[model samples]
Target: MRIGCRQKMKSIIKSFNQQGFAILHGVLASACIEAVKRECEKLVDELATKLLALGRISDTYDDEPFEMRLIRLYENHPSETPTIFRRELHLRGFFELFAHPRLLTIAQAILGPEIRLYPNYSVRPKLPENRRTEVLWHQDAGYTSAEADILRMVNVWLPLVPVNVENGCMEFVPGSHRGGVVPHEKDEYYLRIHDDHIQPVVAQAVTIEINPGDVVIFSNLLFHRGLPNRSDHVRWSVDFRYQDATQPTLRNTQGHLLCSKKHPSNVVRDAVHWAELEFQ
Candidate 1:
């Protein structure tokens, strides 16, 4: 079974290299997923409480289901609601997911033993028909400044609920990363690849339909976009990058080291420690 598992990961790594992305089905434990969900619920509770005090929300929507609560909360006042979570993610559950050994192994295969959890980690709740949540077609590299070529990164994404064309699932152009970073023009909400650069291969894009506990890893340069969420519930997902620790993050904040042979002491110690540390 160990050999079989290793072989499967080998295949996934190969696919990731050639196709610019690879999906690993059922790679996460149900307990791990539940932990993150609990954390998200806690965050929502906190947000609801604050909003109630500030007169931003008439109702907390606490009785709503996890997938529906946030969407319902913001339905009346979308502008006041937050769509993305960053620093607030330093919870025990999120730490367990981010520092998971299996994920770190995959990161190590691609980025060597030294790895850092990149500073761009985010948890997004895509509300139904919200323009603020619809991501445009662009390479992850395109978002970075001059470091687009230097930052070695692989992005990992998974959905809390099953995702498809209806709920803002992502689509990727196969082998698009090979072309490197393409020119991206500024859109109102996000940067989009210039039409001249993406039109030819855009038709060949594959929709990434995935379920909870399924993880998809893609290159930083992969051409990708998220469809609008037409479903009634919020489509929640977390994305984080693992970087080769040897290179400079090129930002003011240095991300936490997840693994390292030389700087073993600097590695994030445990879930409790992760929760204690603030986003840097």
Candidate 2:
């Protein structure tokens, strides 16, 4: 690696180690960002078509901006906007983003050469005033079963549009991951940390704002939450996790390998290969 690139990686790793999260600004190329945006647009279009067929929407809002079209499509039927897309992740654009070279390099730095993309990846669209889209304050590990404490993983969050306090950007309590898994309770929409545990660090939370090509890498044990979408437009973001390939996932399903040295044959070869693989 070049001297500058090496230095950058070192800085990211250091931040992650200390704060349990790191922000890589504008790491993705413009072309890659646009490709993902186009794919998201396609998804919105498909949803609009279905809604029209069901007589839920009269117009598809084709002329609306990419960020606003989804908002308009589901304005009348808020329940229809998809908050997570995991099944059809084999779509070409998603594969490109998931296997992004720079992202993989960062993962390798923390996870070593062998890395597997966790199967719980998701594409979230936080729409305005949508209760289902609002995520509660909790550690990512809390969502998993009891063995979650033993799992080793890093989460990558990439936005398709500018994210800030107004558009439901994520907020994190620095160094919270050091405490390990705290207590969590199942809320209506998702899991949430106990009030006593979150109250102490709640005051120290920091809002994470980034551009489309940037990425936020955080530990699975970090205390974090997605703010409400106070803005008029949609906040689109994709989140996925990477785990050390050698570790046990504690589950029957294993995600695809993104890079490997010992077992090179296990790596996902291309987009077509990813599409062929089952959701598991």
Candidate 3:
């Protein structure tokens, strides 16, 4: 690796080790960002067409900006708006961002050379005035089985649009990962940390405001939540995880191998190959 690139990677790893999270600014190329935006636009357009055909919406809202289009379509029918897109993630744009070499290198810094993209990848659209989009405070590990505690993993969150407190930016409790798994309860839409544990650290919470090309890498054990979208537009972001290849995912679905020094043949070759894999 080049000297400058190596230095940046080292800094990211150091920050992650100390704070349980790190932010890399402007890491993604403009072309990659535009591609993902285009894909999001296509998805919204398809949904609008379907809603119109069903007489749920009178217009497709085709001319609206990407941030406002989704919000307008689900104005009357909030339940119809998708909070997460799990299937069809093998699309070209998603695959490009998923397997971007720079991102994989950062993952490699923390997870060694062998890395596997975890199966729980998602693209979230946090819409305005939508209760479904308000995520509660909890650790990512809380949602997984107990066996997952042993899995060495890191999560990467990249926003498609600018995210701030009003648009439901994520908030994190610094160094909270040092505390193992806390008790969580099933809430209406998400699992939340118990009040006793969350209250003490709530004051330390930091709202993560980020731009389109910035990426936030945080520990799975970190306490975090997505605030409500009070702004008029949608907050679009993609989140995915990378785990050490040698560890078990604790789930039936084995995620795709992203990189491996010992067995390079296992790594995903290109976007076309990614499109062939089934969503797990």
Candidate 4:
């Protein structure tokens, strides 16, 4: 059953705790989505301009739709195409999405009221038939560090376009978080759960198909993977995490705090304030 934002949030919370994940529909507005898309277009435009100056491409592909713009820009240079973006996320347009009240509330329930935007946030553009974009089954905790396994946090995934099995939507094994961190082995480009461990639950995996306004919140220990993008266009998405602020980030750069009762003055004040800060 699809869970809408209007439905009782308690049930969504319940589902997250019981099943290790929950898909919340209609969690964002059209304007909010558009803002992020515009920012994405701007980023692509910069890349196109740089490529143009380098005489890599003759056409900027400015008229192309958001879904195809990046694909068209890098059609001749797949090797140079970027699959992940991180440092450029400090733009003002992303502030609303990061500090969204509804999303923070859910994070607060899973974690505590003091929420810190985890340092691992990123925007991934899954390109068609690109091995670099294909992610294998692995728990995020295993990728971070041993201490990250104990970090109280929730992962958030949102799409900029419609997603399905064809365009590389996420797939998760329900209730997989209860098993703790499973053994993960390195793959060609990503990490895959040990065959012996994941084989028993492969049949339980479910495809996560959602739209721009929907969000998938899951545990860091949840078994999940992104399918190959077989479509003609790109599967654009952003994923981030919210962790309890009281704990050490175990990294050189500490993420910004979204909400905190102990040190309310430190929370990101507003969109402008968010833009002023770096990814640290």
Model 1 has a clash total of 0
RMSD to true structure for each model, in Å: 1.2, 1.3, 1.3, 2.5
**Top candidate (TM-score):** 1
Q: Residues 1-280, candidate 3, lDDT per residue (tens digit)?
A: 8998789888999889888999999999989989888888888888998999999999998999989898789889877788988775777777789998888888888988889999899889998878888999998899988755677888999899999999999999999988788999999989999999999989999999999999999999999999999998889999999999988888888889989888899888888888788777
TM-score, candidate 3, is 0.96
Number of the top-ranking candidate, with lDDT as the measure: 4
Rank order (by lDDT, best first):
4, 1, 3, 2
- Return the lDDT, model 3, position 261: 81
TM accuracy, model 4 = 0.96
Better of 2 and 4 by lDDT: 4
Q: Write the per-residue lDDT of candidate 2 for residues 73-117, one digit (tens) a residue.
A: 877777767888777667777778889888998899998998999
Clash totals for all models, in order?
A: 0, 0, 0, 0
lDDT of 4 at 106: 84
User: Model 3: runs farther than 4 Å from truth?
Assistant: none
- Listed in order, each prediction's TM-score against the native is 0.97, 0.96, 0.96, 0.96
Candidate 1 residue lDDT tens string, 175-217: 9999878899999999999999899999999999999999999
Clashing pairs in 4: none
Candidate 1 — which residues are off by over 4 angstroms? none
